[model samples]
Target: MVTSEWTGPFDPSSDPEELTHLLSVLSSFLSYRRHAHYNGTHVRRQAFYSLPSSHWSLLSRPPFSVLDHLSHLDDLIDQHAELAEAIFRVGFAFLAPKLDSEWIGEVLGGDARVVVGDELKVYEKIMDRLGVKASKNDVDKARSCIHQFYREWSAEGAVERQKCFDPVIRALEEEFASRARCSPNLNLDRSEMSVLAPGAGLGRLVFDICRAGFTVEGNEISYHELMASSLVLNHTKTAGQYTIAPFALNGSNHLTREDQFRTYQVPDIHPATELASHTLNSRVPAEERMSMATGDFCVLYSQEDSKETFDAVTTVFFIDTAPNMIRYIEAVRNCLKPGGLWINLGPLLWHHAAKPPPSEEDKNKDKEDRTTDANERDIGIADPGSVELTNEEVVALVQHLGFAMEKHETGTFETGYISDPSSMLQSTYRPSFWIARKK
Candidate 1:
């Protein structure tokens, strides 16, 4: 029942108008003192780079780039505001159906041009109710609620949720399509090779990979994600049967059998120290468990695996989340065959700074400092976006891992529908696609 109208024609393809709107909205949002505090402490700083106004007009000229620069500050603000509003609406619909229009408005009410700090406070409260906490009982409860909400949202088949990906996917396709095509060796056609997508949220990208002809095997950390992927794959597989090129594999390619797709159980660990131990014990032995272990891009290559087992490895939006980027990268490198390709999409740097000195309450006679740091705070800790590695540093890190960088490009969507745009933008999480082959 929420009502709002677009003041002008909304075009996802054009960048100038959108960029101007995006800046204006952002400025208004940041004008509030609370918003500035949150941005300084909780949000990443890279999220606020000012786009030149002339850049927007470049689209009308030659060599139209991916993102347009803004002319007016208000224009930029509008773009960001629109995206935030859409996310708030979709998230609310999925997670809080019982909330009436008035309650939703109350939660989201702010300057129409920008989100206020109050809005963020409301979001934090919702997250708390959803059970996003560190305690075992609390986390389990939160996971359950999240799973249920995702299921309900999927069932509703709301177009708004689907629309979110339009911008991101379009940008990705345009930026990476040519580079992905250049490497004929990486082109996966469905002769008989197996491809795996661990942490496959909703399986949207997996579906596209399957269409390119690789038999896909998917794993997820959440049961809800696994279920959603299964349902989508099932439908795609059935539909593909009647197509002109039955086995030719196009955009609709999927596993012919349910058993072909396997979901792995993500280990539950009380502390980071126990994560490695728990994973090792609960799953099959490291040597036999997987052809390759999928983690964040920086760490997708495992150091413990034999040299030539995996053909291809993929990671999406993982690098920013990894706690130990160096170790993780080493792990990924160790797992791959000499010539195997590592496909990565999303931000390279996940900003997180070391926590301040512990208060008296945190220091007890028996509590080990290592134990408290590793278990209590390390797993979910994120660096403020203000702290980040330069793009050069990120590139160097990849090269240091023994990968011959094959491709690198940036992608941005216009529709703001490709993934969680709010989280991506707020976190300064760029979609940086790369293909690296081991030497």
Candidate 2:
């Protein structure tokens, strides 16, 4: 089990900028309780009291009482808050090695204290605690991190993984196998085959690809995701070691209270054990088999050294995050070796698609939270103008960028993104699936 009781591998005297980023993530996890308390309990209780007496009387009668439901919801929120607190406790300890007393005093205030030994624990015993308060956006991202664990590391995610990751794995193996037979004197081995997965969330697909025997690197831009992924990939000791109620915060659209408070065991399989099994078969070290790159895909891979360095690139539900689709396409083209495979499966739900201006309240919050948002974006660069395109248009653009289409399937795979299985509301997408080779 991963807990505050377990010490992680930490490096002292790490980069200050990197520590700042990690602290921001830690603050978000720390703030989860307050965020959920207001949104899940206090606000609803206020609305319940604001209702007219006649309406209240009607709700007060029968087997179901509105007040009782509200109280029960508060209980659920408390449970969820406990889970968040546990995550924050361990996360702090995990990152404590890189932090010195001076740095802690500067960032977390002089009142903050660190206890090291079997467990590296932090205590904010004084009235003055952390110097910063996590913004609403940061808290929201932290909440999503819980749901992401279900999507990436739990048994519940197997259905989605089969629909999304399995095809990419099969294609990568088959394509290279075919190449081996077709070209004599051309050298290729699983150890030598380097694959890149941009926008890898929680490292599931990347881990799967590595288990398939190819050396893989996952690139991610979100710190919330990176922090959560680090916990699961690096700190976890066994499968089903942790349990969390991912759906507890959202009270509506549940068939029952149990459904709303459903629990799932994380990391259905221990990553280290599974990877070790692969290592036993291949006789290759895990470090050489998998890695992670942190930064914007375009900026990082556009460098001359990264050009034509990968044998294959896998992108799943990632391309839509791009502001300029052309920049993404160009980066992929430039990074793949001659005739290297490009596998993509996602809908073009452009993140920068036009939207209405923010309301006055939203603008006020933006003013207060802009610094947090800026820090999140500092590691990566983004262009302002978004070039939105249809599915056919994207395929044509891929071809224009010197990639020959090997396979293309449109609106065929029905998949869900971080969806709750038992909820009344379910959103599914018919993502475009295809493989192309750079000529």
Candidate 3:
């Protein structure tokens, strides 16, 4: 715990110009995903000449504006310790000078003369109310979530995500159907199958299953994503009103048609629409069918009522997020009832230790779970200390846990998110389904 008087080696004094530049850059970055406009464009691009506590409400318009519509500011800031911690850490980063210079440059427009905020003293003073001493790693973790949060839970992002994940979802549903047939209690409510998705970032998949007529509960650890997902899933009365995305689309040739600023409106992801979809269980609203549990995946399901086990477990783009794959598989196995289905979809690459990282740009380009120093961690090895098992190895390990393969496929899919229909990520991963009965 850093005391109030504690100080780090970093200098505190920053140029007024740098502070102004930082404020404008962060404000503009926040604006892009909003419905408002800066100079009549989706994003406010002008630099801020000065920023004082008085202008905060106007500043709040672009950044904290959407948070209000989602999670009321009083509740989010005052109640949730995790969100407050994230804000404090990232807030420090935003104001601190030249920390993670390369990444900050990328986010702040990379102008050589632009001074990056590094004033720890100012940051501490500004962030004193939320007095948590967040380290560099903490700042990186928080920044990644707050910065790119829009892409996962936003209206436009959901539509694109559903399309890209069609295969994985199909596999899970098919296996679920088969399992339902074999169960003695086929008479059970079709939506009552106990489904668990660990590392369920933003609860999109959890709600997706609920819509498909399954009783689902998602587990998420990242407080940042949890805060956003909880508000969107449980609190928001209307969807598409919130903005969860858009930092940059300029100069990227992915746009099919030219616009005033080389940008296209990202598709709207309607969370409400997802709930009311005719295909979803019309009998129960999504909120009634699903819930979110916040905790680490590795230990989340272990302490449940010893008799309680899931009918199926779905992990999409999830398994790889862990430092070690074995613990995740073991945890899934522990949570399963006899002959329960386990569906997995995500790249085999370990979150921290993939060797040489497909490419430098590839690593940084797709910054889903990668830390700021992810590239530096890959010290020129064909394989790093982290587990880099092949899809086949993963399956074999699960089979060793007494699971039998039901269906599987490997392929690459381009999923679009982050504010434009054409803007997408081309990621390759294997999708697998297996029925396991405890031996």
Which candidate leads the pack in lDDT? Answer: 2
Of the candidates shown, which would achieve the greatest TM-score relative to the real structure? 2
Cα deviation at 126, candidate 1, in Å, is 27
lDDT of each: 0.38, 0.75, 0.50
Candidate 2, residue 368: the lDDT equals 67
Off by over 4 Å in 1: 1-191, 227-307, 348-388, 411-430
Q: Cα deviation of 115 in candidate 3 (Å)?
A: 30
lDDT of 2 by residue, 1-439 (tens): 2111221122222656555556666677776767777887789878877889888778877665767766776676666555566566656766566446776556444433544431223444211244555656778888888778888998998989999999999998897688777775765567677899999888899889888888888888776776666677777778987776777767779988678777888879998778777764244666567777766788778777789999999999999887778888889988999999999998889887863456788766656655668543322234445667898999999999899999999878698987888899999999999999999
Model 3 Cα shift for residue 355 (angstroms): 11
- Give Cα distance to truth, residue 158, candidate 3, Å: 4.8
Q: State residue 5's C-alpha deviation in candidate 1, in Å.
A: 44
Winner on TM-score (1 vs 3): 3
Higher-ranked by lDDT: 1 or 2: 2
What is the Cα-based TM-score of model 3? 0.56
- Candidate 2 error regions (>4 Å): 1-22, 52-62, 65-130, 183-188, 355-381
Model 3: per-residue Cα lDDT over 319-412, one tens digit each: 6675566666777777888777777666655677643436666555545434655543222112223576777888787778667776666654
